[model samples]
Target: MVSSTISLAPFFSLSPSASQSQPPSPFAFRRGLFLVCHAFSQSESQADKPNSWRQLHWKEKRPRRKANAISDQEVVHQFDQLLAAKNLYQINQYLKDHAKTSNNSYPTVFSLFTRLTQAEGIGPDEYTYAILMDCCARMNQVNLMFGFLGRFLKEGHSANNAMIFSPILKGLCWEKRTGEAATIVLYKMAKLGCIPGIVSYNIIINGLCKNDEIDKAMDFVDVMMSKGHEPNVVTYNTLIDGLCKKGEIDKALDFVDVMISKGHGPNVVTYSTLIDGLCKEGEIDKAMDIVDVMISKGYDPDVITYSILINGLCKEGEIDKAMDIVDVMISRGHDPDVVTYSTLIDGLCKEGEIDKARNFVDVMISKGLEPDVVTYSTLIDGLCKKGEIDKAMDIVDVMISRGHDPDVVTYNTLIDGLCKKGETDKARDFVDVMISKGLEPNVVTYSTLIDGLCKKGETDNARDFVDVMISKGLEPNVVTYNILIDGLCKKGEIQKAIDIVDVMITKGHEPDVVTYSTLIDGLCKKGEIEKAMDFLDVMISKGLEPDVVTYNTLIDGLCKKGETDKARDFVDVMISKGLEPDVVTHNTLIDGLCKKGQTEQAFNFLDVMISKGCDPDVITYNTLITGLCKNGEIDKALDFVDVMISKGHEPNVVTYSTLIDGLCKKGEIKRALNFLDVMISKGHEPDVVTYGTLIDGLCEKGEITKAKELFYEMISKGVDPDAVI
Candidate 1:
């Protein structure tokens, strides 16, 4: 029996070269069987001969019959080939067949899958079920992955291998299945004796935070501590980003403090996220404070952090502060990258400081920083705003020359600029150029051109652009309707503007404050005050709250129509709704009252304005003084001038002139002269109008000598007297 077994081993273990060339013949099988039977008979005949025959048969078969027993190296090679094809099904079949044939060794199967996973080309094998679970998690196929994992665990697979379960946990976390992932991780670690590492905890914490589960994420940190796994920098960063994204900037900062206290230093990403969140919330000063903290913590702010602060400052119209930050960044030995330069350029452009932005571009290039498409687009936008279409076009040429292809934004900037310059033909040509470059124009691009046409009073052409944009599969945003509404209103097409509003509603775009405000202002301008109010009613019916600007527009419109009582009612409605009337709102309301000869009520509104913490601007004083003087209330108007000066608000020429004119209109030549003296004493040189008003008043009062002296004084002060003199 021993000799027979040794002889049969040769049939299974043919030499590698011999087995590849040909299939086993029947003759070879029968010959091997005959040899085995002969050896066994011989072994039975003599006990000593049996041992000798067995040893001789084994020696003979050793080299020729060793193929059936796969080597560890061969198993790894086959497993890799299968995995490379992503042929998990075939790999499973191969493993099962090999395991049955190789005496069912679990170590061999485990080693095969593990080694294949480590190979460069081959991915993790199905035998390493954790990899599939991870893939499922990554693809958000949580249920399907868990089902497979359940089968794996039931089939005697060890769940204790962190190498196997950790990836699965990470997958679950990535899919935002944090609770399930946590439960699985805890179950594997406690029940199945698996212990998670730092990476495993990071995945869960990050997932929880991303899903806006902040409290849950913090609880997970506690769970990690309980499991004796301290959270790492990645873990803290994930939580910070999550909190920042949810606009919980204060909580994010607190997390940063906790991270530092725990000895995990925050990195650039952590700082950038916090800065961006603060900027979005308009807490720009607080954002800058964090930047200082970041610097003091020995963490240099990166390009992203700089971009956030610059954008925030720009949005607040604090261009100088934003530029200061940029200078500081350069002085700190940090070369401004493309985004940093782009942000600064964009901010400068938006502020109408085109020349300064252009000079910065030169400086950026000199410093070896190549201006990207965004940089060019920003410059183009600035130039367009300044009506420098020729310079903006030159920028486009330079962009093409520099091999930095202009995108939709670049085209939109140029087109918008040309539109603003009343060059609709040139703007249209740019749209064509954009299309020829294989770039489909977006709504912003089309909307820009439409707005340009509308501004030039070519509402029909603007409507054509809208149709073109729609035909090209671009849906018009809220701005598109606004431009058309404004255009139609300008052309006295109020009904058409209202129709466009209906279309906007039909298309699922609600009319925002700008939408209603533009239409209302237009209707007011066209003397369609009742229709404007009806539109306001419609806006409110749509659940859109009127902003302070909306109320101010209506008040100004009503005041212009001599309906001061109705305008005052609007103010009451605005304040009752807890909407603090802005400076513009107060000025409009006060101007209305003063115009209606209600000087006392108008001045009372000024007190209310001051009490509401709304500082009255120069316009406020000028409007009130003009109204009071027109109504023969010159003395009361003069009191407001003194109040304005005392409030630290510098009265400009308009404020002084309004009072001078009011005094003159009331035939109070001496008071007008006294006011002019007060104005000149306050370092405001009297203009021709100021002297003319006083001289004219003096002439009306027959004080010709005093009028002549005032005229001579005006001439001496280099104020050229016009024909009215």
Candidate 2:
């Protein structure tokens, strides 16, 4: 007799306060039972009220039963048939038995409850409420699910069965309320005399793993084992996956051993996950060993497994090994898919083997596997990076021909390539094309454009692009700011670059090590050594360690300012900071020492450099030779050239030019001409400096005809004479 338009809001309002900090106690759920039952009882009481218009209307609408009316058994049987068929609408109609429907009707379960109470043969039961609870859980309506649970408990159907609470545990976990799910498994179900089964524990553990609470998830495994519930393969696999994702591959492997010893043999998913973890850690060889072990265990690697191996090998630059794996995969009858081919192509491209990469694309099509968007994009990126911008565009055209639209990533790659080639204008034009194709330029797109402009010395344009990027709602990230700062610094606009850093900080962007290093380099270039040194101190204070480049820049600056001793001290400081001096560091220091006329001291540093296992490059030998030549040690300088050649360092044009200048300075005009001939014969073309030195030498030796002939020969060889000539 009650109106079917019953509201469950008042019952839900009786739920624990939303503002309650702690989780609701088991007593709170018990208290909720009374509140929900009270609501149901109130509705029934109003319908039963004597002299009530609702009761009168209900009496008039009552239909008389036939002689062959359906029995309670028959009704219950029909309800089960409908439930099995999942015919919710028919179930509602059969419960109501020709009752009037209303706009504000309650949900299907509540309507069934209301009608079954009024039905002739049967009423709502514990089994019926279980179905209702499941419905609420499936719909992700956890509050409604709890209300059904409260109703189930109130009706004295609180049996010691875990299935009844399964829906509750599942609903809580699905809503990311894993903590509540755990409470139900650990305490609430126990308090209700329901033993939590393996299913219940696994759901909670999987939920915890998903929440990244791996350690807490492991604790639950211990709790379940203590409670006499053996952890199954699903349980172990869940824990292993969590450990692998957290980069704890060793722990994941340990879990696998535990699983094996417990008679739950490691499955393909287990091996695949471990392999992926090892590959991510750059242990490609170990990952391959894992694959061999998987095969020994009678598990044939699937396409996904093989693909993972191929990807690992490719990442380690073992392209040939990756190809061999693909061959082995094919021999085992696992056809290489697009991902496998794409990964190989990417590896080849990274190694600068573009032609080989392109051949694989054809092979993929021959295998009847069409390349996806990712495959096309990766190939495009590789081509662009190789400075093959035209070829990359052709591939984009081919991609369109194949009915795949070039995505933002494809456009961004093209723009970056053009920018690196110093074609900023062409790169900017790609943005308009990208927008035309309905693909909005993301942060990478705008940042690449800004970088292009900055590198081209168009800092003002780059700044304007930053403003435009903000206007378009794309906030410049730290990389974008760094590019702009680097540009200004390179332009010798140190003050403007410093101001940009201030603005960057104001915008909540913290300057990283690169930012401080760039600032220091700029200060050093501007001869602001004290300020540069202060910036270095500030950098270290902020917990940003100066890299080798930073130390080398400062050293180079000090040496240029006639502070060779200070530069040498910085090398010691760099070593103390745990940064080993690279070749550039040695070269910078040697050049600094040589410029200060400390040729013998520079030789001492070279010995120290070799002792430290830092091999002297051609620049090192050239610096020492220049220092000796300036000290008028032509014989020693020439001997040093032999030492350079003997050490497997070929004498470059600079080497030949330096020797010629040394000989010319010593008034050995004939010897200088012979050195020039030796320079030419070694395929080292005489640059303007080389030609100019020989020409000056000839003119000074009173050989006017020979000097004019050499000058004309230099011009014929396309070596432009400088003002020094």
Error of 2 at 359 (Å): 1.8
Cα lDDT tens digits, model 2, 354-412, are 89988989888987988866677778878888899999999999999998887666788
Q: How accurate is candidate 1 locally (lDDT)?
A: 0.74
Alpha-carbon lDDT, every model: 0.74, 0.80
Q: Worst 10-residue stretch by lDDT in candidate 1? A: 45-54
Leading candidate by lDDT: 2
Best by TM-score: 2
Across 200-234, the per-residue lDDT of candidate 1 in tens digits comes to 77777877887888889889899888978888888
Clashes of each: 1, 0
Model 1 stretches with alpha carbons more than 4 Å out: 1-232, 258-265, 282-285, 288-292, 295-333, 350-353, 524-533, 635-639, 649-653, 656-725
